[model samples]
Target: MSGIILHHYATSPFSEKVRIAFGIKKLAWQSVDIPPVMPKPDLMPLTGGYRKTPVLQIGADIFCDTQLILRELERRHPTPTFYPGLARGLAEGVAFWADHQLFGAAVAIAFGAFGDKLPDAFLEDRSKFSGRNIDRARLKQQAAVMQGPLRAHLGWIEDALADNRAFLFGDAPSLADLAVYHCVWFVRERARSDALADYAGLNAWADRMKAFGHGERSDLDAKAAVAAARAAQPAPVRGTVMPNALGLTAGAMVSVTPDDTGRDPTVGELVALDAQSVTIRRSAPEVGEVHVHFPRAGFILVPAKA
Candidate 1:
């Protein structure tokens, strides 16, 4: 638990959110670069099946999803807190909007703008993950349709920053700031052209978020990361009770799968189940016995055979 390992790749907006979180906390971490797409052979054993970018690892516990990962990091390192006061709720709400609405818009624009230039295989692979048929023609059409809404969202962000506060909820940056910033980063950075070039306010805010930078990161190979997990022991579960609502027990065999497109399930022995999250113990030759934790939201945990 002393060392923090991040399984992520560069150019991922969500990954940037975690990297910046590390910087704010000033935590030392090892970075394991992963594929931008699935078939994440090295990471699947640790994650079970959740192939989302930028998973956080500590010893034998794997924390997937930025929401859970951020919370765990906050619990471990309190200084330079990510969310404070009313900002916590507000930030979470903003982040939710950013993740869904803003992020969707950004992706449409990102892919639409570059779909033609992108390799056919890459686009085809991503389409599978999205659970949608994507083509340059479709992406271009969606990109045009999304532009108006995307700009309107940017305008709201611009107005929010017009109050002259250094960050979203006062001087220090909060979850809202980072969440919003990453979506903005994706569109502007991904689009190449100034998707927000005219928005002076947003540009300035992004500069501040950029200043935070990613914390000290050293490279580690995929094999080394897996080996590290194999050698360590799963951390003791903090929750004592399992949620009765799921009609599940402590040792039930279950499969955890995201409700969205990337629906591959991670089969394991249920270790702990609560309203907030679910933990499962799975063993593989590469990752050995490890506990994988997935947030209850956006995921379904059902009997393995069912």
Candidate 2:
């Protein structure tokens, strides 16, 4: 319940999800700003191989992906629960749809709109990370094609807020608002687009979400974070063992990889497996032994040698 270390850069859209969750919960946390792109040497030690931004670390427990991290945060501090029964199903479904479809389109547009403005090194790193060539022409072309779908997506959201609801699902802000807000934040702030200006309802909703603010944060350097991980011990878990759906079991060597673009795997000794999450124990001289958690929803857990 101590040392809430967040390995995140300032502008990662997914990181904003976790940050907004922290704000909604009013959680106090420490920050370790990582690079926006790859070659995250300090972060690699704790995550084993996963290099995605905004990793959540508590003591020696490392959590990859915002989905898992937000749930963990909710678990640790559950006063204002994220899943209100009335809109739980709607909140989760719409959030997932937005996270993937809407988010992907926004990123494509950003790359296309400003790909030429990016530094060559940043473009090279993104290409390597994406496992594809950085085709500026292709991205620019895709940008034009993507606007229709993107606008349609936003229009749907605008209609959702047309009722003048305080939040997407209800009177109080929930994960649904947070999930959609980050992408809108990206298109408006990061990508610098006025696409939402015409949509009064969505623009107002975006303003309300933004006003929630990022929670308490204190900066920590990469070396300090590495040292913190080395000095800490993994948090104990009493998670019940369930059936091995993957034909795999605890103590097996496994690799946890995201199904999305960041296909890099985090390989370790499987310590716990359940329907919701998979925990793997990995060790490094710098970070000692760490248990990294990844949600089973968007990630794949497979035998290491497979």
Give the alpha carbon lDDT tens digit for every residue of 1-306 in model 2.
357889998778999888888888888889888988778889999999898878999878999988788778878898687876576667777788888999988887777767778887887887877788887668788878887888999888888888888788778887788888888888887888766679888888888888878889888787888888788888886574478767777788999898977799889988888878989999998889999999888888888985
- Cα lDDT listed for each candidate: 0.84, 0.84
In the predicted model 1, the residue pairs found to clash are none
lDDT of 1 by residue, 188-287 (tens): 7767746778988889988888888788988988888988998999988988446576688888899988877677788999888887788999998887
Which ranges in model 2 have alpha carbons more than 4 Å from their true place? none
Give the lDDT of residue 104 in candidate 1. 83
Q: What TM-score does each of the candidates earn?
A: 0.95, 0.95
- Candidate 2 clash pair list: none
The candidate that wins on lDDT is: 1
Clashes of 1: 0
Question: TM-score of predicted model 1?
Answer: 0.95
Q: Which window of ten consecutive residues has the lowest lDDT sum in model 2?
A: 237-246
